[model samples]
Target: MQVLFGYNTNGGQSVQSYGYYDPNYANDIRTVMVAVVAQSHVQTPQQDAPTKLQLIPAVPASQSITGESLPAVYFYPPAGSHNAQFTVMTTTVPVMNMIWH
Candidate 1:
């Protein structure tokens, strides 16, 4: 799993996600991509920007297919005034767990 964050040409935020796979595995190929956006609001002037990345693990009950452990990620803004966005991409056999900042 790999992630990248940067500013777009129009001064907006951009997120790029990439997944790596082993060459040995010819049939086992899968990718799970997750993105979370925290929209900025003008009415909430007192709201402080998040300083850290948050990763919330999925419980058994929250799993998409009964036993799968899907993750929920929160990627905050680079600057306080801009909206926050993040992308999570994974390509592994049986979908391995990924924890990154």
Candidate 2:
């Protein structure tokens, strides 16, 4: 599986980060999971740890066709944050896991 990350800055005060996943298999996939963690890039260690951002599943399990080229899922992180990371994992099988920092 391959995961892609992007960000949009036009809507509000906070920047929005999006995650895209591609299983690259012909068969439909329903067990893929996407997660995002955002941390404020503060200069000091006293800052809080990364927070779990809310993920909005773009496609349902039934409609997650591999070749559609659209994002199987997407997420929006907290606004005005920095140092975002993304993780992709498969729940059903032992496929490779991915993490982006």
Candidate 3:
């Protein structure tokens, strides 16, 4: 599995983003999980200090039969969720793991 990261600057708000993973083989199946965490200093006053990572939302999973390039799966941090960092974890069994930004 592979991961890519960038920012979306079209139209409205620009968002920090990342995506696109294709299995090694044409018939292979894989699942990708994505999450974002706010930088410590970005936490709001009402929010508790985050001691652990939090899940954002699931990126569209990928399945390809023709081995053709799969559609790009992109994820963005919530609006106003500033100073945020993103993570994408990929595994065969739908589990969360380490991903570098």
Instruction: For candidate 3, report its TM-score.
Output: 0.28
Over the stretch 1-101, how does candidate 3's per-residue lDDT look in tens digits? 23332223232222223244333221222233443333443555554432333343233333223223335544445566544443445432322223211
List per-prediction Cα lDDT, in the order shown. Answer: 0.35, 0.35, 0.35
Candidate 1 residue lDDT tens string, 1-101: 23212111222222222222234321232333434454534434455545655533333423232233445445555665433333333422223223111
Candidate ordering by lDDT (highest first) = 2, 1, 3
Q: What is the C-alpha RMSD of each candidate to the true structure, in Å?
A: 14.4, 14.7, 14.1
Clashing pairs in 2: none
TM-score of each: 0.30, 0.22, 0.28
Task: Give the clashing residue pairs of candidate 1, or none.
Answer: none
What would the per-residue lDDT of candidate 2 be over residues 33-69, giving only the tens digit for each residue?
A: 4344434344343443244433444543333333233
Question: What ranges in model 2 sit over 4 Å off?
Answer: 1-71, 93-101
lDDT value for model 2: 0.35
On TM-score, the stronger of 1 and 3 is 1
Q: By lDDT, is 2 or 3 better?
A: 2
31: Cα error in model 2, Å: 6.2
**Which sections of candidate 3 miss by over 4 Å?**
1-63, 66-68, 94-101
